[model samples]
Target: MQTNSSAKKSKHILGLVIVDGVGYRNFLLSDFVNQSLNTFDEVVIFSGLPSESFEMQERANVSIVELPVFQESGKTWFWRKAKEVAHMQLHKYNFAGIDYNLQKNYPITKTKRALITKMIFRITSVFHSEKWINRFYRNQVSSFKKDEVTKVYSELLKREELDLLFFTHQRPPYLAPLDYAAKKLGIKTCSFLFSWDNLPSKGRMAAPFDSFLVWSDLMKKELHFFYPETKKQPVEVVGTPQFEPYVLDRYTSSKEDFYHKFELDPDLKTICYSCGDASTSKNDPFYIEVIAKLMEQNKLIEKVNFLVRTSPAEDGSRFKEVNKRFSFIKWNYPKWELTRKDHPEPWSQRVPLPEDLKDLRSFLKYCNLNINMCSTMSLDFMLFDKPVINPTFGTGENDLYDDQKYLRYSHYERVLESGAVAIVKNEEELVREINFSLKNPEARLKEQKELLELQIGKPLKGTSQRIAENLNEFSKA
Candidate 1:
């Protein structure tokens, strides 16, 4: 555990910390860390909670630290009010039947339970937020995340003042303490593409980082389109390292091995979605019924693999808990375990995934055709010129808040417009499009070439290496 000589050259210690610390993050960090080559005297990782992978990082020239998990203080009336706010914020409409007045927009009726929840929320908001603020106290307010963060950074400075701190995502609760701490010590701070954070109340990525490294020109255009004023903020279209590994000529494992393990037919044209986040388990009205029904009924495509790799995102137990009802076997997604069993995955009410990058790439490579909603994994499919089928679910109001219309188009529009990717508006369309893409893949191949031109501006063989090159220039200073 010796520090690299490079660390001695500068008094400033580069402090790099991440926000979401579960899966592909380690691999993403590896692409950057490997490039650093132990350039920093130390690397500190900030996680909401520590996982097994966090404990095994002794050799990476870094230390993993967990931040306090924020939760509402107690079951006080005020706390309940905060919970109501969170619930309403998460759910589209009020539980109550308040839409009677706002029907132009709400348009729908509510259940008796919904009506009750709405009334409770109405009473809470009037009592807590309008008259007094303390009644709205929640985990965020109780934990004083900003203050706690300030204390953490203050102590880190006391131990060894940082010269530069790079934040993976910027939210006041997460970044405020570090921002204030770094500001106090005159440290430069920046953030990476953690995506639109709904916290901090100060606004979005266009503001936090001193500089940003965007994945594509499409993203850059959207940035300029949305916040047209702050157009001069420094940023780079450095591409994503997540895709760098996907651009290889030869994969480590044979695709046949993936099919045989799953009892999937090799002669069949496979189309699968890495199931971004299945929280409600059997929720998505389309997947549980439409997809399963189509796959089961379609004798023509029975030889074709129509699968969805459900990981542990929205609700970790999605694929494992409910999916076990279908005839399948045991094992995990990370282990490449394919089954249609009626029992639980070994994790006890949870589906498990591998916490490594190699395993993930292997998983992605196993499929001939890929489908997804909004996961960054789609970028990998685009990078390797794989056939893609994208579904624009049109998530109603939630889509409006994030300005999803403008943002998603950065990737979605370009791919769809170039005809490199197919956009299916609904489940029926998805069925038609998925089959069409497979049946006439050569046409897709031509579209894929055009898409390669739009998305991949530079003919990059190693995206990670290019990122490392950029960072090298920054570190040289």
Candidate 2:
């Protein structure tokens, strides 16, 4: 593919890659697309989802291109897994989250492929230098280019005359070819660190971009700490677009309207129990039952309404029996749609609808208290100045993958130290914390603000505009 630099005089086109549902929510569903269009001559969204899934009418100077499903070859997969294992081994002692993941995933009586991966990782760990890590990353990158996807991206980048390529989520391995093509064509590339726990807990990044955009200065520091090579690259601390809707007027609804929509009682204080995915918090049903039973037995200090918001990444069918048992629990099932049923990673193909955004915003705004198993929703509630309680009770097995272990992860350390949230270990503490939080909603106000500042590193408003301004500046350079 030929470069379009000579054909175009001054037209600056930006290519934004959306790798997953969260990316769709953060970029396309937010004000980001409009903001980018305002700053650039044109914007092209290269989405991992099908174009039909968006249900959006294409506007002038903007196009949405659906990416072909990325098929990883066996060799590519092996190297990628090897790199991840080596990275986990390298940082296991530094971050407890990495250590936990390593201990859990390490091959014991697993498949032959797993055993070979472990063997290769052991050999790689013998060297374990930053140089070795970079080599492993480069090998993975090279292996990805062996496929036809690189050519596809090369053609797309050249055809669009894209001056800058930005990845909404940095961790998906499918992004490697696109990143490679951008680099080969000399287009500037930048990747957003997806979540708070991504850098420390998630394995090696799929590809190395020219720069990185992070949620906070703390995250920027984390990026440099985990990938020291990124230290020399530009790391912009623009607060994430994920929480922008919390402050947006259009996403908000009146208290009465919100209560009526969910059949919530306006007279009672609402305690929202936000559930993580099935894999992350399998004990969510048990937690919900405990809360329901507390309300059933009238053990609480005051009668408050219970609201359960299931994870958008999953269907909440698992809570059917619990919902049936607890009639009073107002359930807000997420409105995310499954776009590609045949996709290998079904979770990635799930796309969030715009209505869900409004529903989520309302839930955060009007809910008096929030409860979860150490989720980012805690930060969302904190942004609203609402009290939060993290229930960390497992099945008392004390084995690996216990829900209780999440509190000790590296990312949650700041949360624990902040004293902004109540961490309950058992039903007794859970009852006490929930009642106390409802009674004194402003008890942790100061700490919550401090923690938000530490996590977000920017004012809540205009985060999308900030990101756009940065992207425009990067495109021009």
lDDT of each: 0.48, 0.86
Error of 1 at 131 (Å): 28
Please provide, for model 2 over 1-477, each residue's C-alpha lDDT reduced to its tens digit, 9 standing for 90 to 100. Answer: 545666453687889898888998888777887888778888888989889876673788888888887788887887777777778878888888888887777777778887886787678668566677778878888787868877887887877778899999887888888889888888999999879999888788888789888999999999998889888888899999998877777787889889999998798889899999999888899889999999999988888889999999889999999999989999998999898889888988888888999999998889999999999999998888999999887744754247877877888988999999999888899999988988899999999999999999888688889999998888766
State the local distance difference test value for candidate 2.
0.86
- Candidate 2: residue 470 Cα off by (Å): 0.9
Model 2 stretches with alpha carbons more than 4 Å out = 1-9, 395-401
Error of 1 at 105 (Å): 14
Q: Where does the lowest 10-residue lDDT sum fall in candidate 2?
A: 1-10
What's each prediction's TM-score? 0.66, 0.96
User: Highest lDDT among the candidates is held by which one?
Assistant: 2
